[model samples]
Target: MPDPLGPLSTGILAEAERRWDLLTAADPSLRRAVDLQRGLIGRSVQLFETIRTTGVRAWPFNLDVGRLRSKLERGVPLLRDESWTLPVGPLTDALLDFCRMLEVSGAGASAAHISQAIDSKRLDAGSLLNASLARADCDIRDGAIQLGLAPDLLWLTAELAVSPYAYFLQRSLAASLPPDVLSTWDRGDCPFCGSWPALAERLVDRRVLRCSLCAAAWPAHSGCIYCHEHGDAFSSAAIDRARPERLLETCGACGGYLKALVSDRPLDFPLAAVEDLATGDLDAAAAARGFRRPALRKLLSAQTPRPS
Candidate 1:
């Protein structure tokens, strides 16, 4: 089967590569990070294509438009719907491939250890993928400890692997919903996956939060997304006076900061990571100022339903 998202994915990869080249040319010091991201993006495309060709079914989310609208109004993430199911087989294959890609990319040796564990029957790819998808932090950490690998490293590998599936599901869910129904979602987290925005794109008149995991885009309010504080404590400043487009939005009330970049349009799936990486200096600057991004808010538990 032909990939449904082929053109969009191809465009994202091409644009990301072009941006990566420009970023590296501007600062040779970023070469290492850019190269690692290049490897991950290439592997992600391959995994996404593989899964797409295998033809996974759409998530069985509630089709009642009224109910979906009510849920959106209540600030409920769609992932909380009990009817949704995960396609474990394709996602598991993606996870295993992602582990190997991590090793090949020189991102870490922990993924190698993970692959070894799987080979030795010490780990199950489906279980690992499920844990990662559910954002079961403690489970992942405990498993990492048992495997003698860094918890963060293992979690990162698993999350990256499962992200393509998340993207696919989110896209399908969004497509199924009426445009007005989707527009009702105004929360800080992703309506589909419940993940927080990696950053926001500053369009001509409004800001659009970009999901870190599923790459979903939604309109955002003008204040601290975490606290909804629009008081004087919320302020924005350009990281470099020369490049006013790149900014750091800080909220003193929550002690949280979000990176914002002026863009002509919303970024596609996976490219949000590239933008996040391209603005590493903003992260450093925020850290220097004692501001930090908040941890992923747990909007839902591990509710992975069995595939029908």
Candidate 2:
């Protein structure tokens, strides 16, 4: 499948390969993770075309700067207003393809189990996709348990499949919104998808949060992103004193940690994962210190209604 974004996807994949080579060379243990990520990036590029040409429907947005401000003030993400109904045909195709890719990427028996379940009609791909979009964690967990699959693995695969669609919707929604609306978003979570930032990019003196899901970028708070704790509880340390540009920011109050890197600019969409992978050392450092990244924030809007 040719990449829909053509030259853009080509550049992104090339950059990803460059980074992966450096990361794996520095730490050979990252080989498996790098392989998985490489496959995912390639598949996502293909799916980007699939999503665009299939005419998927994005959730409608008001696009009023005032309404956007109100939503941001209340900690509601921009797309949280209405349930997004993804086209089942494209979504199902993406999910099945990802499942097969996972198998080829050495996901082991769990991947096979999911594939078998879907193939045998024991699992409904559309239902699983909708549940994931709705943030219906319990349903997903139950379905996984019933199918004798690892819940986390199943959820991760579903999330991976849904991500390209989310990316497409977010880009569309973002383009329609006023340019300055994102500036008013102060929450730790992504103003677009409510996912915690994969990492922070420090450009000059300001920190910008990069979304793990849709790869959206937004300004970050001065303090701890999880709890708004800016006191002494919020502190950072460089993993390598010689390289202060790469550091881990930890919030003692919430026991939450975020990896930050000084960069010339925000990372391109989807490439944020590459940065996150390259900084695995920071994640290890934070874990060694007993700090951790927080779970995905379930938006209040996720509970509104199921997608049609």
Candidate 3:
């Protein structure tokens, strides 16, 4: 037997498949995007662990600024200089491959358009890199709009190409932040990348924030750390009480739902990404309950957030 689901990630994949079927049953458009993302999660984990670790890393702290406001405020972002350039050619090729994988899933037409665009040299690695970084600098949802991506294939083309670079970037930035500096950055967003966390892990008694883009992990305060909307306004998800390790925290004040994974041990970022996709039921349930990201976002807090 080939172990149909495999020993590793069998449970996560199974749950994700169930969630995918349920989510797409109501909104068919999510099917291809979800499937494509599922495929890339494994690749992303591998890439993050394999990228050049030594030469491409730096601490982004700035003394003149006093406190970190934005990631770009202090250091040069990847792809801006010759020393920090990404493997743009490989990234573009990967996106095309992911798009092709969507062909059998009734997204053949979308795949064809993306393929044609790439074949005609209408898209190049440098242009794609420029668009992805620019998009990350702004709102994530607005990436499709700002990048002028095709309407139907947001996940397959633009996001896929950008994902590898995001993983590589995460590893580089994660290495730079020291424990003391990380502890002082008591904010919902990553101190290193300034991007929102994809998930938070409870490492024994301490909880750490993991960046969605750069994969940087740092400690944080519990109870709606995202919007600072605690008390009666916040609530843990009612689903799967047996699995308390994973939770979807919804804050009524900001209507922002953050995915939280309470664990006794550290978890891998790549594996966490897989689990992030698997938690679509939580996302859908939150959406059905009118939970959403805050319209006017406030990702960071004042320099002092504790009893100091």
Candidate 4:
């Protein structure tokens, strides 16, 4: 039995192709997302390869948040116009239209420039950045219902499968920053990015805080991941006795749960997303015991605007 997500890595690429086919067969609405996904995938590979060449020690992929901010500001107007075009393909057209809708919906200011740049500059840098932006935009449109912070949404979606290391790096940095730094920062298991945990693991023999962002593995005290609240009250239990090694970290006060994977398990496991899915029994057991995951809604309620 191979790991689903591991095999699904190939599936993601296959799915990418499958999506393209579906879009070609479907109507305008369905075509928009699939087109965006295809464009996003193409651009993602370029960005990931570029950043990976920089090595992990390169401060946050040497990505200047200041630069990202400036680009976004300039890109917003481009994102607004329904007629904007991008080189990523027809998806750029679809994305520009989507951004137009977001502006109309009050989700954020119109990013007409961001939309317009889809195929604007013929230069390599412009294409790469556009692809990065498109990747983030598509994910936001798809996952907006689950998590909603326009900027963070874009950042997380770009990192999801493309650059897991950069993803973790951005998240870790965001989490470590004082709230006074970024006004939009959210304090949650997702660190600062607001992306959901794909899975969690407990190195039984070693103490490591391996965050999904940046893939920066570190030493974290043994306790509940929800609030780092330690002690007997934060006990864990699981329904799969055969896999007693697998359990859920249950917090009584917050009613938040996280998957705890013992080090004995294979390292190849897609611990982030798959852990949660495989432990459906734990979720059921957690609920039976009056516990549940700390959804994005709950995390947002505690959001504090960064002080100047």
| TM-score of every candidate | 0.89, 0.88, 0.67, 0.42
lDDT score for residue 128 of model 1: 76
lDDT of 3 at 266: 51
Worst 10 residues of 4 by lDDT: 77-86
lDDT of candidate model 2 versus the reference: 0.78
What C-alpha lDDT do the candidate models reach, one value each?
0.77, 0.78, 0.56, 0.42
Over 4 Å off in model 3, which ranges?
Answer: 1-38, 45-83, 137-152, 294-308
Error (Å) of candidate 3 at residue 31 is 12
lDDT per residue as tens, model 2, 224-292: 999999899999779899989898999999999999889986686678888988888889889999998
lDDT of 1 by residue, 66-145 (tens): 98788778777765544444566666666677777678777557778877787676777677776666666677888778
lDDT of 3 at 157: 56
Give per-residue lDDT, candidate 1, residue 3: 46
**RMSD per prediction, one decimal?**
3.3, 3.5, 9.1, 13.5
Which candidate leads the pack in lDDT? 2
lDDT of 4 by residue, 78-164 (tens): 111112122233223334444554444443442443333333542222233233432333433433333322444333332333343
Which stretches in model 2 have alpha-carbon errors above 4 Å?
1-9, 57-59, 301-308
Q: Which 10 consecutive residues of model 2 have the lowest summed lDDT?
A: 299-308
